[model samples]
Target: MPPLSFSEGFAIAAGLVQLFVAVVFLRFRHGRPEWGLGWWAVTFAAAGVMNTGAPVLLAAMHSPFGTSLNVLTMVLGISTMGALVAGSRLYTGHPRPGPWWSFALTWLAYLSLMMTRQLWPGYESLIANGVTGLIFAYLGCLSLGAMRRESGAGHGIAAAMLCLYIPMVAGAYAMGLDQVELRYWSAVPFALAGLGVMSAMMGRMRAHLRDLNESLEQRVADRTHELRDIISSLESFNSMVSHDLRGPLGGMAGLSGVALSALDAGDTERARRLFQAVQAQSSNLSNLVADLMALARVSNVALLKQPVALSELVQESVQHLELSHGEGHAQPVQVAPLPVVACDKALLRQVLVNLLGNALKFSRKAARPQVRVWAEVREGGVQVAVQDNGVGFDATRQRDLFTPFKRLHEERDFEGTGLGLALVRRIVERHGGRVGAESQTGQGATFWFWLPATETPI
Candidate 1:
């Protein structure tokens, strides 16, 4: 109703500012309780309400009611301090107990004393100011320790402002200054402390964003490397198809023309021989295509893993090899107890067949050719080895053994499309395993693979 003073004008503006800050904190606090923004919002809201209400109530009610408003203001001030401290601890990841009891006890004690203010009148304001100042000092010390725990500009600023506020309150009280004068000096630092809190929250959010970006960048890098490897493999496959398939197709075409000429010249036997040569070439091409299909299948198929007895699979492979090649039936294969592994049974069977077939084929030249299959369990899982007593290859070139169409032996001595080991490698890798070979020229060779272990025994 009356003209407003400078301190009252400042108090109203500061209260509005604090209320606006509380609203902003509330808006950002959604789904982020860990940030402690909710507590900060309470701190500002309570301070804003007390600051705005105290002046209006003091003007309207000049007697005991006015005195009661002052006590209420002090009580709310303690609440704001508690909320600020709680928010600070939560933000820095060092939480403390709730300030409800302190608020309740202070309110009850002060209210009881205020009822008897006629007897103890003047001392109440001093006591209230002193108590509030001491608490603020304590909170400042807490913020100082928190600043040391976590490097943040906000904590330091809040501590400095709170600590600075104590001396101002003490000086004002000593000079017997009124509430409006006290509010004038205290409002600036209070507002700054709120800004400091906001700064700490912003810094934390920035750090979180930085970590997320780094993780995303690392994922992108890994995916890029994988895509590059896929491209390289595609290129190698195209090269092999062009070179290897063209030769066989060309030989077949040439043999067909030559046989036609022999038939025209009335050379029946020559024509028959040429036709047989063409058929052999056609057979080789078919085998190569089949191997290529298998390799592609291995790359794309999703694995269905189950416990399988690898020893049984090895025996079946040996029997099948004997039946298919005819001569390898005489080769003695010594099979040791093999561990049971979790894998796709069909794919794993194919792996055993290729490995055993190669072992028998390579070692059949020995006077007493022998093929040995054994397994060992190690820290890295189960390793199965197929060794042969045959003419071994150069160990230095062993890495190339699993490459499609890469061969160490002459075609005349050994018959193969050079894709068996490559297929073995792919199948094993698809099962989350690895394949390798060890050998020295003129000695024996050992081909080994390892698979993740299962609970099943040998």
Candidate 2:
């Protein structure tokens, strides 16, 4: 092809720049939901088309058609100002210029020029160009205000608007004095301004993506740690259960065999004693097995939530304690009315049963043994308290309370597997509740738990 004309070369360069900006705009369109930035992209792209096409048309046409094209360019210029105002308003969170006023003012200005063009064709282009330049200058001031206020996307757009307007301003000044070539170089800065805005938007998007990836990685790490803790707990539980049950079960079997042999040898008294010892050992073994199973079930069972009356649970626990200890031997226990809560009824009852049982067992030697159950309403939940005037444990020994097989008293003094409170804690926590105790040396102990309240059905 032959060497391209000035207008043709400028149009080709502007078109290429427009294509690049259009691609950038499209790429980030879905990623950023900010309306100001979106409008800026659309305005810049449309301006690019007008800038590229106008010059080519001016070069190809003459007289009336050329004049009409110039008028169309002036109209596009007014639209560019309106877009800038609206975009700035969005970025700054300020009230937008009324649409009706903007439309009326812009068209009124253009119509005055149209009439001027008909009356004085010679000066029409100059007047239209000056009016367009003034509109751009006014929009630039608004953009600068947005930048000063530190609006989102303001700095980048302000810089781009400044870059684009500076050349147009310079071209307008030169053109007033009949210098034409200066206006030709305006395309270069216009393209640079468009590129700058797109680059800023891309940078913001990349930062957002990086933050999202970091958050996802952190969540994965936390989940992995949780799974590891759960596995470790399960292994420890299995080891303890195996070691505890083996010796007791073996002894019961051996003792039963011995009792049978004694009876066969015709030693009646010795056989009777042996059989009694076997029965005691068998009962002990049975208790241990039952406790172990209860603990295991409590740990493994999933929480089933429903509205449970706390008073009823406490009453049931007290009745069971009374039955087990018997009226003659059992100490006086006091319980208060409680509010309803949302929790797993079975698990919560198990917790209360263990706590009350522990209190009764330890207080058997106390002169005035007492156990009290009550609840206090709290913000968003309720706190249930189980207090006992028993052989209270030391506060220093608090950590051992919820560990399996860690007994506070001797096995002879208290017949227990030392898993009751541990089971209580596990069950309470599974129901999204918390359990804790308050005690001092020789003083009474208080075990309390908090459960979230349930909303009443409408």
Candidate 3:
């Protein structure tokens, strides 16, 4: 019912400010408990309760309950110091062991001492102020060191405010100041310390946002580069379609017309030969379309890897080539004991078929045509090679041998859409592998690819 004193009014205001800080820290903990904001919340809440309870309890100091409240407030104030130290350390990524239990033990000891306060008489105020001053100085030193090391404005502010409290605590204890003067000294610094903690949290959030923004910008730049590469590839694909597809289509149209004219002129033999040429062109067109589709599928389809014996795949590929050309007996392919590999079965099969087919087609004209399939196990992976004793290419001149629609020889000598090796490269790369070729003019050629020996689940 009485009017509030200056100290009481200031204590209430300080308590409100500290409670607000506690609520803010509590909300932060709710979102990210991993950051350990709960410690600071406890620190500020305890300080708020101590300050807010001081005014009423100070007036009833002579009573039994008042004495108990006084002791409880002193315990709360000491606990706030411990919690602040613990919270600051954890926030900076350095944590003390058993902070909670250590402080609990400290409170129990203080409580025991307070129970016998009648024996200490006038020294109680000196003891409490001295202990609080020592803790303040220690915290100030810690904050100062952290501020210098981390260049944090919050730490600097906290260090300055906490250090300010040490001098005021020392003066109050040395001069035997009244409870009102002591409360004023403690309340101002306590409010500033809360502000400093709030600043530290804001600084952390700013740093996090900066890191997130940088990550997003990096992703955007990488995506832009990938888009540019895709555009360039599409342009090359369009060019190849226009040039290569148009040639075969034009030839077929002309050949069909010429054969029809010969048939009308009653030249049956000439018409029959022309019709056969048209059929050949149509077959080549079909094969080209098939290779194009295979290339597209290799680029788009995800790899499904599994353990497979290279020997079985090699034999199957050879048999397929033999069925396609009917001259497999003349080529005489020798497949060595190939190592087992972990790869997409279908894609790997396509790679073997293309490599073996190339070897057979190129070497078919040799006097003693021979093809060999082999594998070598290296440190981290296995190397598979398809070698042939056919007319090899000049490796130095044919730099882009694996480029789509890039032909090393004339189409008349070797019938191909120039997409086979490109498809092989795409499939190998998709499996996290590498492809290479070794060749010399008039000698043999070896096309090799390397794949990881261990199976990596997709």
Candidate 4:
């Protein structure tokens, strides 16, 4: 065994360092969709073998079979080039590398060509340099294609910079036989530059991963906050239902017992009155249950949307309201022509029905029970409003008016379950719209909703 020279020793050290880098990359990560770094890891590892041994082997050693070192060097160069090409393609989102056998067959051919050179010594330099040049040219052209396509950051930078150095490396290696001392050392600079660019690319990937982690954390936080709010809302809803139902249930129970006792004592009139009270309580309970179900459906059910002409819809809703309230049909409805909007027809019909009903109910005492239905064009949508000359509520209590089982007027004054407006808001919002109302005490109230003008609903 012989000791190493200066350049050979430097090459050996660089090769070991390259191997260390390869090991680090292999340990880094393998879960990415783009596996360029994975291919790159293989690249540095193979390169480590060439750098560490190629210099000494070519300069001093000989195969027992008398094979020239040129054969091995050419094969290694092309193999390294093949890995680079595959990695770049993957990074650029080109077709992924083919089956392992495809690469294996390619490697076998390279090895076969190297062996062929040993058999044909006269044209050996031509075979080796020519083949190696083709490999570099293929790599250079691939980099150029990727550059034109504007591949990913890592691929783009490496291609853009390393491509410029490819010709010099190929030219230097092509003259390897003539310049024995310079050929191996000449390739070192370009290889080092390529490795540097790869490191930059890997650094970019690390930064991107950090950004992804931050984004994931933010989404988790947002979801946690939303979950907490939903839990609080459920608690409040439970409390409201329990408190509201208790009074009516107790009244119905007490009224039933009283009516039974009155019947037993032979008091027909008292029994009839007590039974009527029980019936009213039963009706209230039924309405509350119906409203609760409607709210639940509104939250859970998917919408079926269609383009609705508001003018015809308003008239139809008004007619439905009039028929439902035979006496309140006297409340004349004045409507303005409105735009076409995309919405869930069934839900929008219910919204109009509820708004019109409120208008008629609150204005029953007016000299002329008149409800005005109108609409206006607005940015991104159309806004339809239902206005009435009625006993409007206080502005401060407006927010509470839409709450489930919250009635602004007494049952003796105006009968309702109070889920009407709440249901309206939920349905409208689900359709990507908004509902609001404006009123002053004793003045007319105008309840309005904005429907987006969408060509298609998804």
User: Which candidate model has the greater lDDT, 1 or 4?
Assistant: 1
After superposition, the stretches of candidate 1 with alpha carbons farther than 4 Å from their true spots are 1-151, 154-201, 211-229, 319-323, 326-331
In model 3, where do residues sit more than 4 Å from their true spots?
Answer: 1-15, 18-90, 93-152, 159-194, 207-215, 305-343, 363-390, 397-399, 431-434, 448-458
Give the alpha carbon lDDT tens digit for every residue of 298-352 in model 3: 8789888889888888878877777887865425788888777889988998999
**What global local distance difference test value does model 3 have?**
0.81
Q: Which of the predicted structures, 2 or 4, would earn the higher TM-score when compared with the native?
A: 2
Candidate number of the best TM-score: 3
Model 2 collision count: 0
Model 1 TM:
0.63
Candidate 2's C-alpha runs over 4 A off are: 1-159, 162-198, 205-236, 268-300, 319-331, 377-381, 431-433, 452-458
Per residue, candidate 2 scores C-alpha lDDT tens digits across 1-458 of 25666755775586578657766675666665453665565666766776566555556457658777767766676676566555545544555464335545666777777766877667665676666667656655655664565425635564655546545665567655332333445556556655655655555557678889999999999999998987897788778778778877787788778888988999889988877887887787788788888987886777788888877777787777778778644446687777878888887888888888887777767788888888886667788888887778888888888988778878787888878888888887777778889987677799988777644321
Arranged by lDDT, best first: 3, 1, 4, 2
* Candidate 4 residue spans exceeding 4 A from truth: 1-204, 455-458
Per-residue accuracy of model 4 over 176-257 as CA lDDT, tens digit each: 5354444445346435635654565566567678889999999999999999998998899889888878978999999999
Error of 1 at 402 (Å): 1.8
Report, for every candidate in turn, its global Cα lDDT versus the true structure: 0.80, 0.70, 0.81, 0.72
RMSD in angstroms, all models? 7.5, 7.7, 6.1, 9.1
Compare candidates 2 and 4 on lDDT and give the better one.
Answer: 4
Alpha carbon deviation, residue 183, candidate 2 (Å): 15
